[model samples]
Target: MKNKNLSYKFYVIMSLSIAAIPVVFIVLSYAMFFTHLGITSLFNIDNHFSGSVLTTYFYIVFFGILFGLMFIAAKYFKKIIHRINTMEQTVRKIAEDDAFPEKLAVIEESEDELNKLAASINTMIDRLRAKEMELSQMEDLKREYLKQLSHDINTPLNALNLELYLYSQNHNVSKEEVDVLYQKVDYISKLVNSISSEALFDIDNYYIFKEDISVHKSLKQTINKWSYLLNKNNIEYTIDVQKNLIWQANELWLDRLFENIISNIFKHSATNQIVITVGDTLIIKDYGVGFEIDRDHETTGLSVIKNICQKLNIQLDIESTNAGTAYRLSQE
Candidate 1:
């Protein structure tokens, strides 16, 4: 395909060379006629040469000029063709190797059409790279949202499953418990619908649902929701919170923060006792195998916790040792 395109330009130059033949013939015939009439003063000399020699010199000069022009044109076109092929090869390498490259070489000193073409190609490559980065970031954000959604909904579903199990075992489940389960179902529905919208695509627009709620109540509810899992793992927990402690916060986010902390404890902390204390601050500490603070360590749950703390204007401090890990949260 590349050779075919170059051949077309060669054909065009050949056609131009052929078209120059008649113009050359006309000039030669005029010169020969003038010499035949002894009107050779236009040649800038007296008639000291024969007509045949003068005719030969005219033919040589005109045809030589024609060939010289053709040679110059072909050389110029060859440079252009080489430049275009270089650009084509660069693009082909990127497509075939799927690798990133810096911008194409653009000769800023020249104000010709080829320089403009190179500039245009560089601009196109930059825009495409920017768009690719944007898409990649969006994909990462989407995955995070999905993981958060999974964690948020999973706790409530587990609570619901526990309720069903208790009922099956002939245990008396209260009416208020059923109402709370209904509210969780409704909250999950709203979250799912919101995540489906374009608002979730941007980080700035992620959390808009906020309300004034009792912090004690939200924390207690989270513990109760995770009661089944905690018992299954033989992990005991205690909550010490003031009954009337209230704070303005996103209710779901508050619940998620507590739930994620508790979930992380069960998953990572190899201990049996978990304690929570809530007042001006909320603290959850576990007697378990803690990690080194200086080391870089992160998990999905911890990342979600940090993000929520930042969003809700909460100050989060974590202390870890071989004995235990303590997470302290306070409004800032």
Candidate 2:
């Protein structure tokens, strides 16, 4: 397109110059003819004819040279304009859709702004692709974590529901059996509460607060809360802790944690006697069915244990087997 424009311009200039030759010739001839016709030069016709002829010859030679130069310039300019138009269209297409063709026929101009634009666009595409991949990976990890958490929460929930249904249907069931059923329900509730607390912490970074906590009082209260279950289940348990042990933490959260650990012992351990010793250290030991260390360590119970240990700045040591399970928590 540029080449064509340049050619047209050259043609126009050449045509104007050619047309000027006749005008110049005419002007010089008119001047000479007028001079000859003048009263002072009425007999100078020969001089007028000679001058007119000479001017006409000069115009012919001038037009020939000027036309040649115009033609050459027009040809090259046309090529340049064609290349520019092609590049312009390619760029417009790329702006509309980034995946537009790459092989554009551009002029061989060095280090131009268009070249830099293309490089920048390519770099941007690369970065976007990388970010997309990262987001996909994150989504996959989130899905897997949710699946595991659901499995952990549902298992105990199912067991608790079944036990409650049986107890409700058989009013004549022994008190001993009813107590065991209630203990199972309590255990499930504590587990659910722990999961809920952790979830709230993850999302909101705080738990609902009930203030003025007394650690010793809370422990005793929690024990009394589960006293009926322990007594009817024939599980001998004792609490030996100082009465004034106090701390700054949410009372409800701490109560739930204590309840969960103790209930876990009742549900899973096969021991008839459990002992709670609280002083500088808090220990809950069961002489019933102990934990299968290798198996229990891999359980969700251990995960809950780890989270609680970290939160309370306590150290947890567990020793278990078919013989019994002993869990000891030490202040740190």
Maximum-TM-score candidate: 1
lDDT of 1 by residue, 234-330 (tens): 9899988754666678887787778788878888888899998887788899999987754625752677788878878788999998999999988
Q: Candidate 2 residues 10-30, lDDT tens each?
A: 677668767876775567557
- C-alpha lDDT of all candidate models, in order: 0.75, 0.64
Query: Model 2 off-target regions past 4 Å?
Result: 1-212, 298-300, 321-323
RMSD of candidate 1 to the true fold?
Answer: 11.5
lDDT agreement of model 1 with the native: 0.75
TM-score of each: 0.49, 0.42
- lDDT (0-100) at residue 199 of candidate 2? 50
Distance from true position, residue 2, model 2, in Å? 23
Q: How many clashes does the backbone of model 1 have?
A: 0
